[model samples]
Target: MNLRQLIDASEGVVKADRVITGGTLVNVCTGEVYPADVAITGDRIAATGDVTAYIGEHTEIVDATGKHLVPGLIDGHLHLECSKLSPTMFADAVVRYGTTSVISGLDQILVVAGVDGVREALREAEQSPMKIFWGAPFKTPYTLPETTVGFNFGPAEHEETQDWADCYGVWETVAEFVLNRDPDVLRALELAHRNRLPVFGCAPMASSTTINALSAAGIRLDHESYTAEEALEKLRAGMYLLIRESSVAHFLNENVKTVTKFGAQSRRVGFCTDDMHVADILREGHLDKLVRMAIQAGVKPIEAIQMATVNCAEMYRIDHLVGSITPGRYADVLIIDSPESFQVERVFSRGVLAAENGRTVTAPAAPERSAALSPAFQVPELAASAIGIAAAGDSAEVLVVEMDRTVPFVRTRLDLTLPVKGGVVRADVAQDALYCTVSERYGKTGATATAMINGFGLRSGAIASSAAPDDNNIVCVGANREDMALAVNHLAAAGGGQIVVENGEIKEFLPLPVAGIVADIVPEEMAAAEDRLEAAARALGCELPSAFGYLIFLEITAIPDYAVTDLGVISYHTQSVVDTVLTSR
Candidate 1:
């Protein structure tokens, strides 16, 4: 079938604007290789065949010699926020890597999606060749208390505070104002559906009913399961599963039985990198590593590919445009020497050459410079007296942090009594681990309350990370209270970034101006910065996870034990929030 002749013969079947030839097609339909040509029209696959009879004078032709044509690789689940890049830059980078589509991770909710940010991202994504979809943010900085909580504050109270939105007003409004009054959840769902994008979210294990309700409301998938049992329940109840890299890795280390038990299910399952760090991506790989991990867990290679590609496209309703290289599917494909190895020979996106010999052909725009550092990270000037603790005796019993090895929820009241420094109960680091604090960076500046934590092998010094999306507050973790104070003071001096401080001196620092959390730098630069930071941590005698492991603790969604946000110390297991000032003492 020549390009013009194929178009003319199947006028109703296709309206191609361009044609591509000279590539082998990855027939995902049968998991085989074959030769074919493909034509595309206005972001959709028109027709595909030999296309020798369809050649036309006006049709733009791409000679994809020595390349493979298949459907664009689909990232089943990923958070653009993790890249810390804007939508355009993220799309540009991933497009060059042969990813034509991605399901935007739940980060939209935490950053700005509720304020029409999602629509804006979608609009910008359409300007590029790659496709973008988003999952709505469903978790709350506060819990859903009742169906009808009154917004009792009068106009006078509103005028008295600017901290309203960042701390409590916005959340209250979403509950009592937006979600409670307007049923805006349904409206948001409808808006996404109208725009033809996939909508998925976080559903905790305890909230099965809400999951059912979300499914009823048109949410098609979830990515927050901690166990195979939880995943199986959702699958049986009609929700597709997106196994995140962290969650899967955690569970596998705990016990691989569940995965070995249910690893082969063809439907209702897919892979997601979720919140992968740049260092991990560079050292490992993206979805390539995810697929490999699944296959190692006993999943079949073809089934893993289907989960990564076809199953994901089906959930997002883009299967017609991608997920296979059939007669009418786009020739976005990958050719490799071995399916199990995932070694790339050549790659195609929309039937056009994108990458060859394991390197990107396109250069995405450089990321924009970050905003100047904020003074909010500076520690308050205080005498040693300010770090005071009060208890009935020399030792005080407290709720020690008990983190679920897999899920984000932490168990509280695992009691530990430690030496009281100056009257303040403190972490017993020599026993193994201690606690840290992460003040929410989206609001007014405030110190996060300190709590007991374990797992990071820190003997001394402080480690700080931030989720300071818009606000400038720095989140800090330390075994030594004096080091915590000194690190914050130093950050005040150096601007914003991850810093490791020991005995009142800065050992290593990675300045991240983007949201006071991410760096403006690329993966390689960020990776180098992380290496330095890790060395600093090891110099202080800490080694278990990377120095960036504290980064995971700053995120409220994944950490289950007591966590410090701008709101104070919140017990995710108990749904109780205590004032930081009161809790630390």
Candidate 2:
């Protein structure tokens, strides 16, 4: 602050840069509302009171009469890459929804592209409207030896996170801990702590024993609670619950019962959209929609706003700089007509008008990003013979994954008999079984594995993607190997992307050439392609949740029950490669 200028403004000798007058300020810090005026000088708030005495000819004024002025909404946790839109496009989509800050999990791109990937993500963040922070990934076991991904962390990239990121804090999952636990995970946690970063835990469906172990290990919070029982357990274990309302994980309804269970201690709860797609965010909303859901579930509006703002900012350790409308902080304020209607008329960021009437006033200009940051794909070639299934007998018993249409994460393990011809086993679509294959993209290993899959509901046609979770590789499932090969090759030719093929022809496709994780396109373009893909998927009789995203996790090693990788099918209970032929091994 300029002492002379501050004194002059106090004495009505100089004018404040901007002012929002005649508003009921929702003071998140004090849980109070008062009719006041907010004065902004440059990027920081200069005063919060009746500042008419400091009005001058050059001062800009915003009329907030009868509006509730609250601090900018902060999204506690998210993966911006999940939107499949570049950082610039993602920011444009959410700023109008009132999210001024975001904490992004770096696992997706980090696993796909490594240190350069992390750097590119940070580079994109600098151009975004929201204040974006990183959550450094602890991929641990998958970062080495058997079934490793493309991304490898070195000393140089590790140094970059020191100043701007937090720990992902997960040791993969409870399954990995029980079977593949390592010392490096603990070392990573300690490093994060030494830097004063909070180690956020990933304890989905963990037993009470595991939760206690994690708490003792210095993990401070969890967003993996899927039920009220789970939520209460984590909260009682001194873990703050994120109450996720993601595109895939719908835990907010079940977790919100904790407000009744803990009453005032509900302050320990906040909201997050761990991974949401563009269409969902565009149609339903973002953190603002999550807050509205909380209120509908019986949480008071002020407390809900508190969870979205102050409590979350405190968790990020940036409360002094944001999370509330106070002096010496960025002027991020929302003008709301009412909490019941949840209508936002205006949004201000850094004392500048950002959004009004459901649109951004100043959308980020689309730029040709630097080549170093905008990565390209380089997956190797594979012949149609590469994705074949071999059998020794006329009929073979094979271990297949059973999927449930409603719950995307949970899968059932099953052993089934399949027909064999010419010492080869093929997908039996009549039995609702489709042949699935996963291949190593980065290594171009040409190593591929195929298995019979159920509950994915694909009767015909094939889908291929390079965004296979955990260790992003090429994964495709189809009634015929020929179509599967076509889908895979289509994605390869596009550099990196998702593809749909039917009856020897291409159906729908969406390219994601940057890091094999995100598409450098606007949300509308991406969402439109997704719409066509879903239509084609439905026409082919596939019944997965969202055709665009759910199938990509077919190989996610971090989740439970059963998953597949280019290496082989992995049983989460054992965390080891399961025998494809049930009787052989």
Candidate 3:
């Protein structure tokens, strides 16, 4: 917007293009509510008050009587690719729920297509009604050489990305690097510090001392706190705490106690869904859902709104652009029924009416598929023998990665004996010990590693995913080798996707042909396909809450205990490869 026009509109010398009158404004900046009229000139909020003199012949007047005007909600941190939808589709899914802005590192796509892919995604984001701010991805593979990725983001990449117009901060500095003071990470952190950018952190279950170390490393924000104590420790260490509520991990209820019990201030706390499925976003609301849950958990209504809006913007250092219904800011406002219910009646993004009554007014056109985001699968054809674990004797004692049923992301190492037949270690279905494998798909090496995992509860089928976290390898788990091989091969043939196979037949498949991570479909179509995949998995005797959820995280090396990569089963605690079979006798 032109500075002179904005000034004239605010001074009433020129008429505002639009005016929202007769609403009780929820002032998130001051925690106060009062009657106000918002005047918009171009895409910025020109003024807020009576605004009687700003009315003219062409002025568009929006009557917000009996409504509460609020700043559009912002998600402090998230991975847009995890929604399994394109940027336009994801924006359509969340804009109706009052979320007008999101911050992401584009780390998933970066892993597959490198820096060029990130640039493609940013160009696509421009077509959406919602604002997308990017962070320079700090770590691409996210760990040691055990994890494979197409790109290795480091100081050079950071320097290039930090100069982008939309780049806000450095994204997700993992705890292992910060704690160990890795030289490459330190150099990246130094560049971020020199550029006056904040560094996002990933330190799950960190102690107070570790938190102190992280704070001293210039890390200013974290979203992995699963408990109220962890949240409070980050707060006391001068770090912003982003309470996460994702599809696989629900830590909001437990972490919100920092405010309800310990009386920690809400300014340093915000809301983020680190990763969410498209179906979940459709079923449950987006940031609007977080606001309601926080209010229901004994937080003040206004404070919950603050956490969803201003707190998040302040945490990312973008408060000057968004997070409040103040002058000199973008005119992104929400008309809600009331503060207690927080039901969004209408959404205005940059002074344009974007959505109303839980639906976007106009759906954004999907961007043309970019070549950079095309299918990334490069694995060789596989056979049942390729996925089998060979044994030298009749029986073998193996180290199994046990999935914790309560916490889907947490895995525990287990040692158990299993019978061998046909010189192959058979999965003991009765004990729920299933076979798991991670196959290299980047074509750097035709490698596949097999391991045993318990508590998946798959009785007679196999599930495979090419969207494995950190490294987008093809990870498969199954009751038998035949089904596992079928599932893996089917996924690669389809380019990239998640699939379930039963009795050597393909039961369900959800294609994610974009860099093996995102689907170029509408939100409704993506959600329905996910629902069908979940049902197919359930029909195959899978007992997890979300079968694909478990499939995607199988190769995530950042988590604790044990994880499967293309190299083998890795012990996160030891940072070394663990033998899948302990003894054969």
Q: Which one wins on lDDT?
A: 3
* Winner by TM-score: 3
Looking at candidate 2, the ten consecutive residues that score lowest on lDDT are 166-175
Q: What is candidate 3's TM-score against the reference? A: 0.98
- Assess the local accuracy of residue 31 in candidate 3 as a C-alpha lDDT between 0 and 100: 98
Give lDDT tens digits, candidate 3, residues 249-356: 999999999999999999889999988888998898899999999999999999999999999999999999899999888999999999998899899998899999
Over the stretch 1-585, how does candidate 1's per-residue lDDT look in tens digits?
456644553453444556777766666567666677776554445666766445565667877676665556678767655554455555544554456677653232234222233344455566555666544433222232211011122223223321221211111112211223334444544555564545565554525665556566555676666667777666766767777664223443222223458553565566665555555565666666666666787776666667678778776666765787654555566655445655555566655556666555665444333222122333454232343334545676665555444343343435666777656776787764465654433333434455666655578888775433222245566678788777655555454567888887888877655434444455566667767887887777675555555444443422354554444456655545643323332
Off by over 4 Å in 2: 1-15, 140-146, 154-160, 163-181, 261-264, 372-376
Q: Candidate 3: where are CA atoms >4 Å away?
A: 2-5
Error of 2 at 29 (Å): 1.5
- Would you list the rank order by lDDT, best first? 3, 2, 1
Would you list the clashing residue pairs of candidate 3? none
Give the range where candidate 3 is weakest over 10 consecutive residues by summed lDDT: 143-152
Return the TM-score for each candidate structure: 0.76, 0.92, 0.98
Error in Å for residue 303 of model 2: 1.2
Clashing residue pair totals per candidate (backbone < 3 A) = 27, 0, 0
